[model samples]
Each structure stands twice: as C-alpha cells, then as structure tokens.
Target chain A: MFKRSVFVAAYLALSAGAAHAEFSGGVIKIGVLTDLSGTYSDISGQGSVIATQMAVEDFGAAKKGMKVEIISADHQNKGDVASSIARQWYDRDGVDAIVDLVTSSTALAVNQVAKEKNKVALVSGAASSDLTGKDCTPNTIHWAYDTWMLANGTGSAIVKTGGKTWYFITADYAFGHALERDTTAAVEKAGGKVLGSVRHPFPSSDFSSFLLQAQASKAQIIGLANAGADTTNAIKQGAEFGITRGGQNFAGLLVFITDVHALGLNTAQGLIVTTSFYWDLNDQTRAWSKRFFEKHKRMPTMVQAGVYSSVLHYLKAVEKLKADQDGAKVIAQMKAMPTDDPLFGKGRVRQDGRKIHPAYLVEVKKPAESKAPWDYYKIRTTIPADQAFRPEKEGGCPLVK
Target chain B: MNAIFGIPTQALFGQLLIGLINGSFYALLSLGLAVIFGLLNIINFAHGALYMMGAFGAYFLLTKFGIGYWWALLISPLAVGLIGVAIERLMLARLYKLDPLYGLLLTFGLALIIQGLFHNEYGSSGMSYPVPQALQGAKDVGFMFLPIYRGWVIAVSLVVCFGVWFLIEKTKLGSYLRAATENPGLVQAFGVNVPRMITLTYGFGVALAALAGVMAAPIYQVNPLMGADLIIVVFAVVVIGGMGSIMGSIVTGFGLGVIEGLTKVFYPQASNTAIFIIMVIVLMFRPAGLFGQR
Candidate 1:
C-alpha cells in the first residue's frame, strides 16, 4: 500500500508538468527592457535583445506549435521609465514576461510593477541582491548574478590571499550599499578587516579625492563598491595616484567583462572578478557565444548570457503549462523544474525566487596573453551552485519555507 | 603627523593637487564659454559635444591612421575647430541676431544629436586611449604621487588659458572683437567684418574646449558622456566667475576646484555639489555674478 502511494505521487507530479493550458492571446510576448543607450548599454543593451531572439529561435517555438514574440525598449536606467514601460507592456501589450533590467534602480522598480500586475520578471542584469532577499516576490525570479554572490566569490578569495585590511570607496546608492555590506561580510568571514569607507555621488567621474581617503586609511585592499564608469574611473585614478604601486590593491566589487574591455588588459590585468557566466567557459558556452558573436559582434557578458538562459527557461515553462495566463503560476513552475541551458548549465531556481548557479572567479588576462578581440578573463575557481548565492533560508524571503 | 578638521594634512594636500588638476579642465572649458559669450554674444551649448568629438578624434587618429598623441594634440583641435566654424556659419550666425536663447537652444539640440550618434557608435562604455609613451608614470612629490601627465595638463591648460585671456583683453584683434560685441554696426562701419570675426571667435573658443578634451584623454576614459558630466560643473564655474568674464572664469575655475577638493576631504558627500553651492552664494550676493558688470 505504501509502494502504491509513492507511485501515485510520482505519477501526479509528472502529469502536473504535462498539464495542458491555453496560450493567452494565442501567443507569448516577452519584453526585453534594458539599458539601451545609457552607461550599461554595452554590457546589456541590444545584446540582450539578440540573446532573447537567439533563445526563441533555438527553442524552435514555431516548430513546437507555440508563438513567442519578443519586444525590447531602452529603460535609460531610470526607475520611472522602467516602471511605466512595465505597466504598458503588461496592461496594453500583453507582454507576459520582462527580462534584463540592466541597473538596480530600474530592476527594483520593475520588480514591484511585475508583482502588482502578476507578470514574470526575470532579472538578468541588475546586481543588487535585494530582489531575492527582502524584495523577493512570487512573480519575479532573479535569473542572473547579484551583489551577494559577487562578494562571496571575489571577496573571500582576496582575503584568503592576504588582503587582510580593506577600505571601500562606494557609490552613494542602494546598489553600492548592498555591495559594500555584502563584501564587508565576506571579507570579515574570510578573516580580513575593514578599516573605513567613503561614499561618493553616483556616476562621479573624478575619484582622486575619494581614492586619497581610501589610500590614507592604509588598507591592504581598496574595495570599490561601485559599478560601470564609477569603478573604471576610480581604478584609473588610483593607478595615477600609485595606489597599486604603493602596496595597496583595489578590489572592484562589481567588475564586468565590458569594464575589463574598456580599461583594456593593460590596466585591468590581474584584477579578480566574480561572474555567473563566461563565454569561453566550455564547449557549449563557446559554441553559443560564437553564434552570439556572429550576430552581435561582441562576446556575451554574464548578463547577456543570463538573458539567453532565463528566457529559454521561461519559454520551456510556458510551453510546459501551455499558458501565459498567470505569471506567478509560471514562475512557480519554473522553480519546480531544474534549469539546463547551454550558457548556464544545470541550474535551479529557489523558492525565494533566486536562481542557483555556480559562479566563477576570474582574473583579467594581461595584454600579451590575450589572443583575440574581446578575450579578457581566465577562470580562477568556481564557487559551487549551492554555496554561490546567499543560502536560501538565510535570505529572509517570506516565500522561503 | 598633521591634521586639519579631523583629516590628515598630507592627504588634504594630495586632494588639493588633484583638485587643481581637475580645475585646469574647468578653467579651460569655462574660458571658452566666457570668450564665446563675451565676444560672440552667443551661448554655444555644443561645446560639450565638440569636446567629445575631440576625444573621439584623438582615439580614431591613433587607431586608424597610426597617428600619435603629440599629433592628436594638434590635429584633433584643428578638426573639431573647423566643425565649430561650420556650426557658427551654418546655424549660429542666424541665431545671433535673435535672442541668445535661440543660440542656446540650437547648440543644446546639436549636443544631444552628436552625443547620441557617438554613443551609438561607441556603445557608451568608451574606448581606451593610452597615455602617451612619455607620460605614463607618476612621481612621488612628498605630499602626493602626482602623475606626470597631470602635471603636463596643469602646465598646458595654464599656458593656453592665459594666452586666450591676453588675446581677448590686450591684443588689437581682441579690442576689435570686444568692440564688435559692444556695437557691431559701428565695427562693421570701421571695415571690420563683424560676422567673420564672430565666427573665428567661436571657433577659437571651441578649439580651447577641444584642447582640454585632448589633455583629458589620458586621464579619463575617452567616453561619450565625459563632456556631459563636466559641462555642468564648468558652467557653474563660469556663472560663479561671472559669465563672460575671462579672468574671472579662469580664477574661479581653479578656486572652485580647490574648494571642491577641500570638501572631498572634510565632507566627501558634498564634493560634486560644492561648486554649485558656491555659485548659489555668488549669485545671491551679486546677481550679475562675482565679476559681471551691472
């Protein structure tokens, strides 16, 4: 009788995934809301749209007798613009899912909008960990990397390697705060100490003054808890100020591939970074990245790779349920299934709406070591999928049982 | 082992030097705005866009044509200055007879268009232009590690700024230009082609901006939005110095850069706003600006 009961439960779970439902409007519309022309454009702009298209084509939705349409727009990295677009897409355009919000402000704003409207938000680009922590919602799945994961992977490594003291030059914003807090935790946990930190206005071009303060603190590691231009500027000026040459190093808490590319291997060499994906990771990634390169002319950043993976996974879930009627239902189903895509393989979404994937710590290659265009990093180590992100129960998400 | 306002004295000196380096950029940019506003009697909002073009111009010359930094210093300005000349002739000249607001609007629109086009091409992360081979390192000068390139920047900006100030305030041509601004009809009666003089002055002002951009390429990322970022601060410097006052713009530019640098030490959060706060104070006390004549 017990054996029969086990068999019955297994049969029911399979049937649930096989459950057939109608496709709303006879089609599934996905909106690729991204930073198209702003600072993050290079990292996650038109490239995201192309990634989504590649996913749709690779999924062969047409051959499967399902209609999947992709639409994209520039968020301009503004919260108001992103939420307004989110409302219009959900209400009027019938976009069942929005993906690749490039900046944290836009992502947080769109997350709320997605929750209210009961649509799926697969956050692929934004770095803040709050989306899956305090701000986790049933309708959103943080599909890419986040601040906590980055600090855990890159921060601990630096500390273990004798970077015992830290001083942070942070951007004065929520994203920066989260990055700084998360990094501080990781640094301390790994037996390092944080001496002091200073916050500069966001998007600040000159970092000399703030950098001097960090320098004066006599910290072994100057942690830059900022992203995009702010990080690059600080690093560049720190070089001019002899920060690195004077026996201190800068830990760029949120460095991206495009940043290394922008700084060039000459300056970015030896800088450690944590990322969820690298195009050259394996045969599968290389093959997919090659196709992406052919289309976009640039290799995929982790965010772009995540967009392809998340969009592919979202489609698979939609196709399984055969409906876009309820975004929360689809997101729940996405969580129920394990993710296996070429870019980020064999991952799973947690109950807290955080996607679980192993993140890699990579060091930027020197100029002489680079073989071709856009070839930037060499992997150092992998933080396992389970340990890569904040532990599910510790996230404080109401959704986590 | 010295301290001031709870900050170390050595670090404060480092910040002041850094501020002076950044201030050189403001002084150069504001000097151009001052000249254009004083002599041309037209506001050139395209100045920032022209500055971006200057950086891109340097980036392209080196990558595409095998040109080097010294040549870029000469070529980038000449090329951007010509574009400025064309803008003055084709668009700005017509608006000169109208409200200065028209000139401001036209150039502001042009800035948007140019910045957008460059952004589309560059993708906004920006391209790297290496520091010239000779200017690649820093020297420890007791108080701070000053990058030789920054020192070069200070010297170059100072020479060019004082050169322009002299040209405007003392030279015979500068007198004719100032006279034209006062009474163009009388200047035209004196056989001086006021329109052409106005065009050249605009070009010169723009070239000064391009010169600053070239100097900045080594220090900052050659990004599309670099000018857009600094333009507002430079404008504040001009306003605080009394818009259209050349010496005033020059002095206030360096002064505010130092003030902002001090703020960075005492209260780091207020550094970006320090210049504007000074502007607010100056405007309140003297509505015509610190040096603007009533």
Candidate 2:
C-alpha cells in the first residue's frame, strides 16, 4: 500500500510541475476584446485575433522572464456585453491590457471599464473621433483611424477640387453623425455648400429611395457618411441607380479598400476616399501585407494593419518597462516614446492618447488598372500627420490640459 | 399651393417615389415570412442568413461560374431551397414534436453556424456583385434615371409576391397546406403525406428568402452579416403586419418602408426609428396586427 501511494504522489507532482512551467515566471496577459461573432464580425473579428497572435509571436512570444499570453473574447457588438467581459477580465482574469475593440460604441464602453480598472486599451478598429475627444480616457489610446482623418482625407480634398455643392446620405447613428458633422465642417471650410442630406437607418438593406433623392438634388458631390455593410449597400445601389453618370461625384467619407474591392473597380472607379493604410500603398506595405495575407487568406485591411501595429507597440512597451504585468507603467512608457512599426510607418502618441499618423487619400482602382487580386487602390495624396487629426487644443480631450 | 411644411411638390413626389421603392423590398420579404410561418409555426431566424446566402450565390455564379443575373435569379433560390430541404429533413423534422420554440432555436443556431463559417472565409467587409453586362446602364425616365437592375428588383418582387399569394389562396396544394396547418393528423389520415408537405413547405418559404437575396446581390454587397442586421427590422415588420394574413404582411411591409423613406426626407433624425415607432403604434392599437383576424 505504501509503495502504490508513493508512485501516485510522484506522478501528481510531475503533472503539477509541467502545468506551472506552462504559465509561471512572470506572465503578461492581454485581453483582445473584439466583435468575433456579431454584426461587425467580418470587419475586425478573427482577423484582429490573428493580428494579436502575430504580435506575440514577433516578440519572441516572451520577453525577459515573462511569457506573453493573449486571451480573446467576442464582444458580440453589444456595449453591455463588452463591458461585462472587460470587467471580468480585469477583476478575475489578471489581464493587463485590452486591444482590438471594433465598434465605436463598444470601444467607448470598454474604454470606461479599462479606465476604471487602470488597464491599457489599444483601440485599433473603432473610428469615432470622440474616443480622443469628449469621451477620451487616459488609459485608452486611439491607435488607428478616426473621424477627423476621414473628414480631412476625403471631404476636404473633394471640396478643394471644385466639387463644392454637397449632399449627404448619412447613417443615423453616433458614428455616422460624427462623420457627417466632421466632414461637413471640412467641406464648408473648403468653401462648399450643403444643399441637403438624408439619414438612413444603420444597416439599411435598401437604398434606392435615398439614391433617387440624391439624383434629383443635382448636387455636384454626394458624400456617403456610413461604414461597413451600409456603405457597401449605398455605393452598390448608387451605381445601380446611375447617380454618378448624372454628373454627380460619389465620395465615400469612411471607405476601406475591401469595400472598393467588393464594389469592384467598374462601379467604384474614380470614387475617392481616405484611409490611414492600404495594402498596396508601397513596397513596405506590400511586404507586410504579403505575410498577413498568407496567414489570414485575405489582404490585410486598415483595421487589421492597425491591430498588428497596436499589438507590436504594446508588447514593445512591456519590454521597455520590464514589468510584464504593470498596466500603468507600460502605458506611460508607451506615451513617452514614439511608435515605429512597418504598418503605421512612423507615428507618435499625442497628449490626448491619439496616435498621430499620416492619413492617405486613395482612389478606387479601375478594373483594368488592377493587375491582381487585392490590388484595389491607387494612392492619390498623403495628408501629413499634423493635418490628419484635429489640433490638440481643439481635440476636447480632458487629459490634454 | 405649397405643402403644409413648405416642402416643394416635386421634392415631395420624388421622396414618395423613394418610399415606394423601399416598400417593395419590405413587402417581398414579409410575404415570404408570413407564408413560412403560417404552415411551419416557426419564425425562421435563419431567413436573413438564407437571404444573404442567396446574394452570395448569385455573386459566385456570376463572378466565378460566368452565369448572369437572370440565371442567378432562377437558380440561386432553387439552390438555396435545396439546402433548406436538406436542413429541414436532416435537422428540423426531429424538432416538430417539441415546443414550437425549438424550431426557432434550432434555426437560430443554424444561422449562427452558417454566418460564422462565412465570416471566417470572407471577413466582414462587403463584396460587390456586379450588374450583368446586359443590365449595365439606367433608363432615363426624365423624372428619375432608374437603373435597370433596380427596376427589375421592384418588378420581379411584385410578381413573386402576388404569385405566392395566388398559390396559397387559390390552389389545391395551398388548400392542403392550410388544412395541414389547421390539423396535421387529420390531413395525414386522409392519405396525404403531410410531414413531407410540411418539409417542402418550409423549403419553399426558405427558397423565397433566397430568391430575394439573389436579387439583392447586384444591388448590395454580399457580406456574411448582411442578413443579421436586416432580419431584426424584418421581424418588426412581420410583427406589425401580424403573421395571420399573407396580404397583410405584404402591404404592411411595403407601407412601412415607404413611411421610413418619407421620414428620411422630412425628419432625418427619426428615419431609422420610424418603422419601430410604427410597430409600437400598431401594437398599441391592434395588437393582433393591421391585417390579423384577431
């Protein structure tokens, strides 16, 4: 009996030791809160998770004596669901930072929870300017695109080119409203007039009526202030209804290359839009995009690229501080230094926690212009970082003062 | 004379035309839902997914298989219907004896699984399905330059909606369906294969949704989550129309769509909430629905 008990005890100790080795010795846990299985699932879902994994792997999967662990959960595109998950991750799961929140509403909700928990939030997907504006949090960083960049990239550029008379098909939501308001300001500043506008429900499937009104208005420019599937539907229906052939230009205020690829160059040709990143921008972008496509099976979108850069920068911050699990120290170190990543080019974090990066104005490639799959955009111009975002004093970030 | 709100007549009429176009989709989708619900007693939570799948079917047929929109219009729905048949026979038939809620739950689960698989393959960005070469440009009507595809959608949806109504209301097969709904055991005792009919009926209803989806592909991007957001609004439309009458579902769907369009012109802020507001009013006044017998 004694011999049998000794053998069992020895086996139990060996198993426990292996388990300890797996997670022990200073672990840094990152919670990737994303819309993995909901309305915005296709936009930033599993791709964001993949980007986080790539960042961890690039960092040698460990730094100093610490092993980097990435834990992911689907926010399901609901604010309350995101908040609950974030609360759980902070209070019980030993998570030091959260990244890749996709929707503006969910991002804001998570930002508040991250603030309360004193954890770092590297927001890569949500594009609301308010993340760095009225709703800004000290613990949160708006890492990718925002309303200001989109407004300056598409709205101002078109207005300056003499497509001055404007109408808008605005999505009726906070994010939509912000895009419209910011883009409208940019247009009016460029000596354009707002002739009229229409607000469609978010995720509206039919846009024939809106297009007809746009056609009738005879506006020189028709701006689409929507994103995701709504923008896709509006642009497609706009082509079907022949709004462009009637001498009106269609401007996508918050478009991505994927939307252009979906609309195809035939319908999307000559449609100008602004974005922070495009896969085919240059040799550098193409190199990073090639690896991402190999892993994800699709070209990396601006959101995906942002996810890669945010994760890389956060991991770098962890290494600099040498404290694997210190959220505040790591965040302070991140803001104290400039960010250098292949995806973002060269960027810096401002006082308001806004990541300052050059925004690009890209036109949809003509079908004949695209030589291969995923080659959907041609860069029109580059908006300098200083002009891409609102000035610091005007940003309305309470932490700025 | 100027309008009460001082809105111009031409603009009002233009906006009204827009409303009518939106109403067309509402009517078509709701009619399909009502037909399926009457016999199956199950709210197809996957109806939107099926619709989205149909759009993708048309897109794939055109882009990869070199098929055109017209062929897609016919084959895509049939293809999706076959998928529906398989699902019904393999999975849904087993849940019939349980609470009707099980069918809803099962279909919802199926929707999630299908949508998840598509998202995994095609990320969230919308992909465009091009208009066929023949239907490339617009018809200049002076008042509006109507794209040929839009005209086709409005016209085809009308024909399909009425054709469906005629099938259920005037045909012997529809009589059997109605009878089965009233009492399946009695219909079975009369030497009718009611269970098979039930399965086919569900498949047919699902096929209608898929047809709408295929028709929509050229007009909208074919995205994985396309059906999810549209489905809730459709459910609200169905609820307001009352699942009792097919024609009611069709009319309410179209009427609410037009109202929503008009709201976009007059009160831009309330445009998104207009349909839901109407639903609330309908619930308050006629809880059974505008056309419901109750």
The top-ranked prediction according to DockQ is 1
lDDT of 2: 0.79
User: What lDDT does candidate 2 reach at residue B210?
Assistant: 90
**Weakest ten-residue segment in model 1 chain B by summed lDDT:** B120-129
- Candidate 1 deviant stretches above 4 angstroms: A1-21
lDDT of 2 at A263: 66
Q: Judged by DockQ cut-offs, is candidate 2 incorrect, acceptable, medium or high?
A: medium
Interface RMSD of each: 1.3, 2.5
Model 2 residue B157 distance off true place after TM-score fit, in angstroms: 2.2
lDDT on C-alpha atoms for all candidate structures = 0.87, 0.79
DockQ for every prediction shown: 0.66, 0.58
- Writing each residue's lDDT as its tens digit, candidate 1 over B1-294 gives 888887778888888998898889999999999999988877778888888888888999999999999999999999999999999999888776688899999999999899989887777778778889898898989987888999999999899889989988999998998999999999999899988888888998998889888888878889999889889998898888887999999998888888888887877888888888888888999978888884
